[model samples]
Target: MPRLGLNPDHLALAGAELADESGFEAVTISRVARRVGVQPASLYSHVDGSADLRDRVAMLVLGEMADAATSAIAGRSGRDALGAFADSYRDYAHRHPGRYEASHRRTSPSPRTVDEGRRHSTLSAALLRGYAVPEPEHVHAIRLLGSTIHGFVTLEFTGGFAHSAPAAEVSWDRIVDALDHLLRTWPTSSTDV
Candidate 1:
């Protein structure tokens, strides 16, 4: 017998909320059951277990990130698009720190997750089109961009900049500008030189 008004999606949503309230590691079937006023066994019908629940949270986070990235880069190009794309990631991390952390977890691939992952890649490639990065170098460029954004956001999110002199915002703008210039002038292969 399933509980009324409770399903996989609802449970997943509750898990995500719990992840945000505490860390992702804090999300457990027992805790979520308490959250929804049910016993731990009651959630078994909705989620396979803790792993399945975490996978659902990962999928939800990825989907939300893809949607935000898509919206952030729409009708924009060049540095404007680049900044917005980068900011979208930072904003999402700040807004949903736990869900953002869950996004880094490896999960079993399902159709929805695969599609969301592809959409993120497609959006990145599309954003890169505004710069002069050759197709061959796009993978490298994407890695650089993703690393830079992730590194900066992680540090900022974890109070790494608390003791800094200049504001993190100032550094962020400079970093984005530097990325823009670097992408615009992406170097050619050594053989071409």
Candidate 2:
């Protein structure tokens, strides 16, 4: 029988906290069960396995990230919105390194996760709307923005910037400014001269 006062949500939450505290790779059914004061088998009642637990954590992190970005970008537009979105992403990654890493993991699609992903994509599309990026190039712009933010945050987290000359903050700002300019001046055609 399942433990009293234990449920999927509780297990998932515990798993997420474990991931945040000790990196996503450290999250496992045994660790989560231990955290929740239950036997490893007790966790099976709440989660399919470690993968399901991790997926739940990933969904949670993605939703949290979307919420942060939405709040940060509200009532803002253009470069202001861009900067706010990027800053929110970086801040979240720094504050929740393990959960942030979990957010990057690919998971099987479910209604909730699909909607969560849409919310993120919609937020990014809204940011691009301010720059008037064409429909045909939306995917390209989204990929570019995602790559830039992910690259920067991953590097910053891994001490890649520890040996750098100038401060990373200065470089982040410059990158945002450059991205904004690129979006604003994106070519309408690919025809060569």
Clashes of 2: 0
Off by over 4 Å in 1: 190-193
Model 1 misses residue 99 by how many Å? Answer: 1.0
Which candidate has the top score in lDDT? 1
lDDT of 2 by residue, 1-193 (tens): 8889998777777877888899899889999988988789988888899999888889888989999999999999999999999999999998888989999999878998899999888999999999999977887898999999999999998899989778899999999999999999977767533
Highest TM-score against the true fold, candidate: 2
Cα lDDT for residue 108, candidate 2: 77
Model 1 pairs whose backbones collide: none
RMSD values for the candidates in order, in angstroms, are: 2.1, 2.2
lDDT of 1: 0.91
For residue 126, model 1's alpha carbon misses the true position, in angstroms, by 0.6
Query: Model 2 clash pairs?
Result: none
- Tell me each candidate's TM-score: 0.93, 0.94
lDDT of 1 at 152: 94
